[model samples]
Target: MSVSTETRIKWTSADLELLPENGNNYEIIDGELYMTRAPHWKHQTSIARITNALVSWSNQSKLGQTIINPGIIFSDDNNVIPDLIWISNKKLESCVDEAGHFTSAPELVVEILSQKPNDIKRDKETKLKLYSNRGVREYWIVDWQLKQVEIYRRYEGKLTLMITLLDDDSITSELLPNFSCQIRDFFL
Candidate 1:
């Protein structure tokens, strides 16, 4: 929502550029400025654990490159940052802009869900719809509190539930063969 002190100013991708690097996350949705609070250490721990495994798989298989917190101008009015994105080398070479934003959607985006209510709702609904419509093929929502990951894949241009991975399950992407890890590691 509109929380910026600069009242009545519409937030845009260009406006996001004007923000100082103040260790805060700013996102815009439908012309509203959403100032996201910094996440807790638990969030960082989960991300680090999962990223380590992803890096290992990517390096071993040469599948692609993984980036953290990629700034993307999804639309003229939506300039949100995703937590982690894995882009196939082919897409990376062709779609990465001079400013480092990916004009083309990444193959996969991983969102580490926070305890905050808005964060949960936005990740499950807002981001799911946004990324899916933007052509992100795979979306993974990681919930440390639940110790699970929900995978949504693009099917016929709509997001469909691909899988719900629990702690005991080995998480694998049907889209990315040979890339997988134990689901519980994400919470550790």
Candidate 2:
């Protein structure tokens, strides 16, 4: 009798370079490759609104920087492009690499959930675990379709579910001092 074994390919950041710029988003989580097509218009709008709020606050506070769709490379096999990220000036200096990608975790990471079930799972479960394990201080999962935001804050050395804000409610962050916005703003 002959014994055969199957070998699975563990994707890495190097493999991402081989893919064409085809208007799709690709990420490697735990050595697995996940891809999604371009997001919907509402998704883009939500990002814009969130960016505007974060950027405005960051500019005034001068405490950190807010960026959209930055490639955060925790490792060769654990890289992701989050919807948005806000990193303190101190942490940014330490985590950013010469290639201009974040080599480590940021202060905060945000993900605007897409319509697809897989994408939703990636944000809420897979990426949540990845960010928590890698020491991200805060993580926000925004569901524009539902007009809600789930905020996770670092607690006892891990990201913990702190609160969920509905459309009528406002959102605030301890990581970002004095930063507040209504949940409805994200949908608008």
Candidate 3:
């Protein structure tokens, strides 16, 4: 699981403090700082499409607020930057921390899987379990390469695959009530 990169920096709260207020994104996983180079064009397109769809649905229907690329602090030492998160306003207010960690997990978290094989595996399996254990009721994994989005639902203390949505299909989340997205818009 290690990429053996010499240029990487170890992460700490100080490093987090030192980050510029610029729009660049970073995630701290177990004391390792993982900085994102700008996501590719297709990735950005997909991200925007999903964010727009979720926000529109949530706002009009009153399911929850659509949060885009916010820092989700999983622990004192672990901070995650999810691509999209949908949290009820009540949840958002209750979860804010003095240092800006999301103390509470969102009801739905969406991760757009990168093309790298390690990333694909990490998002599909490791992150899915992590979110489920952390009480995210719905986890969506969007695979650009595969042209599919896998929706996972937490049931009876475990997460099970609810559906694999193809490009022509429309997918919705149970946690957010009426939030839905067209599958093709994500890949287009």
Candidate 4:
């Protein structure tokens, strides 16, 4: 198949109102529209594992809630469907609008990189910069290929590399306070 080189059509959060309910993941980054195909089985499994771990911790602590594929609008031109979003209980109401979408940045955004080269590159570079610039408290990049998870936390006004965990290591969040999971478990 030939790779398309056409520039994407510009879009805003308002444009999402016209879109029908579909399996395709629609997002807008810096005013450009991007449509991602449904995730593969391994990708879905990894997401589920992370969600499972977060759910257990959040439930017991009453710290917050973990949601899958929530529309997070950082700006009119920057709308994204994160793989998993965590909102702390304190700011959940203020962040989420009446439409059940987050109008502001969530505390944490998790992205499980796919096997596709374009997506892999975008998550590591482009999205990392976007989330950091938008003031997301933490960002997690999960790489099944390398069996590792990279956590970035806001520090000194920029997102800084907090920790890089291998499959054998566990992810612990000081913000979450007692929340953790084995990196290997997230892949399984």
> Number of the top candidate by TM-score?
2
Write candidate 2's Cα lDDT for 108-161 as tens digits. Answer: 999999999989999999999999999999999999988999999999999999
Candidate 2 clashes between residue pairs 3 or more apart in a chain or in different chains: none
| Candidate 1 global TM-score | 0.90
Give residue 162's lDDT in candidate 3 (0 to 100).
Answer: 82
Per-prediction backbone clash count: 0, 0, 0, 0
> 46, model 3: CA deviation in Å?
0.6
lDDT on C-alpha atoms for all candidate structures: 0.84, 0.93, 0.78, 0.87
Candidate 1 lDDT over 1-188, as tens digits, reads 67757557777888877988898898886777777778978887888887788888889889798788888776768877888988888888888678878776889999999888988888899888888888999999998888999999999997878889999999888767877788988886
Query: Model 4: runs farther than 4 Å from truth?
Result: 1-9, 19-21
Q: Compute the lDDT of residue 169 as modeled in candidate 1.
A: 98
43-155, model 3: which lDDT tens digit per residue?
Answer: 77888888888888877887578887877877755678888888987787799889665877898889998776766676777667678778988888888777899888888
Q: Candidate 3, 81: how far from true, in Å?
A: 0.3
TM per model?
Answer: 0.90, 0.96, 0.82, 0.90
- Each model's RMSD to truth, in Å? 4.4, 1.2, 4.9, 4.5
Question: Which ranges of candidate 1 are over 4 A from the true structure?
Answer: 1-10
